[model samples]
Target: MTVRFELYSTWGCHLCEQAEQMLQQAGLSGQYQVLDIVDHAHLFEQYRVLIPVLACRHTKATLGWPFDQAQLTAWLQLQLQED
Candidate 1:
């Protein structure tokens, strides 16, 4: 099963940058789509305070900022199970 992730974030956000680096370190960089909330009105509103969110498109699961490698891995596992 191929897992796809959507990273909701905006430019110049430190947390967003960290989240992206975590994804890269996890070897998930290619499987994710970076969606800049600033490009979409609804997305910006929905995730204004929740930037740096990692979302599973198939399961509709979301992980907010301040996550580490362990949390990201667990979140992915949970989302996979839900799918």
Candidate 2:
């Protein structure tokens, strides 16, 4: 099964950059899209502290920030299995 991870991010977020690097190191960056929520006020406000959130494309299951390789892998696997 293919998993598409979407990360919500914005400019000036060092943590978001770090998360991107982590995903790349884990070889998962190519499978995801990093969306900048700065232009979307509601999204920006809602996700300011929640930047770097990961979400499944098909099911929309959300995983918040401060995640690592294992958590991301587990979340992706769970989402795929649910589908």
Candidate 3:
């Protein structure tokens, strides 16, 4: 089964942009969706200070920002195993 991911982010956030670029660089450009926190009140409240978070749609597992490609790969692997 294919596991999809959500990238929680907001516009004009440099770090968020970096996270997106990292995903693209990691060859995951088509594997995840970008969700703007500003459009969802609950998400906005929960991730207001945690934009750039990557979440597994199936497991609800999350990885916060400041993560590199290696960390992202490992996280995805772990999530796959859990699910």
Number of the top candidate by TM-score? 1
Which of 1 and 2 is the better model by lDDT?
1
Q: Write the per-residue lDDT of candidate 1 for residues 1-83, one digit (tens) a residue.
A: 25489999999999999999998887885788999999999999999998899999998878998789999988888877886
lDDT of 3 by residue, 1-83 (tens): 24388999999999999999987887776788999999999999999998899998888899998898899878878987986
- Each model's lDDT comes to 0.88, 0.80, 0.88
Off by over 4 Å in 2: 1-3
Task: Find the number of clashing residue pairs for candidate 2.
Answer: 0
lDDT of 3 at 60: 88
Q: What is the lDDT of residue 19 in candidate 1?
A: 92
> lDDT of model 2 at residue 56?
77
Judging by TM-score, tell me the better candidate of 1 and 2.
1
Q: After aligning candidate 2 to the native by TM-score, how far in Å is the CA of 74 from where it should be?
A: 1.1
Sliding window of 10 residues with minimal summed lDDT for model 3: 1-10
User: What local lDDT does model 2 show for residue 65?
Assistant: 85
